[model samples]
Target: MSETAMNAARMIDMLPDSDQHLAYELIKKLVLAWDPDFTKLTPEEAKLLNEAENDEFVDAEDIDWSQIGA
Candidate 1:
């Protein structure tokens, strides 16, 4: 383990049970954000992203916000 990781683990070990659980949760969230799985896009997803990039967007005032529950 890296020095920083070792130090963090030592600090976490000193925490109370409740704090340890909280630390674990925060660590898990950080680890997940460190690697997102977005290598492949479904056809429908690809189409939406493509349209967003290439299409003319609706004007903010023209959108019926309630219709989309926004």
Candidate 2:
């Protein structure tokens, strides 16, 4: 994989499962804004790309998973 693709994979692994969908949405928006020529990504890859794209530098403990169920 290219460095960009590898980095994206790592980012996806770091996200909480609950945030995966949101992550994918964010990635798609970014890809659309930045490069329309970006290859079409599978839903799974899109989710991972999104997570990586939006990943904020923070401790995982900062989020409250209990509140996510609402």
TM-scores for all predictions: 0.50, 0.39
C-alpha lDDT values of all predictions? 0.85, 0.83
Badly placed stretches (over 4 Å) of model 1 are 37-70
Clashing residue pairs in candidate 1 are none
Error of 2 at 48 (Å): 26
- Per-residue CA lDDT of model 1 for 1-70, tens digit only, reads 5678899999999999999999999998876687556456656778989989898877899978889964
- Displacement of residue 56 (Cα, Å) in model 1 is 54
Residue-level lDDT tens digits of model 2 in 1-70 = 6789789878887999868778888888988987788777877899999999899776779988789878
Clashes of 1: 0
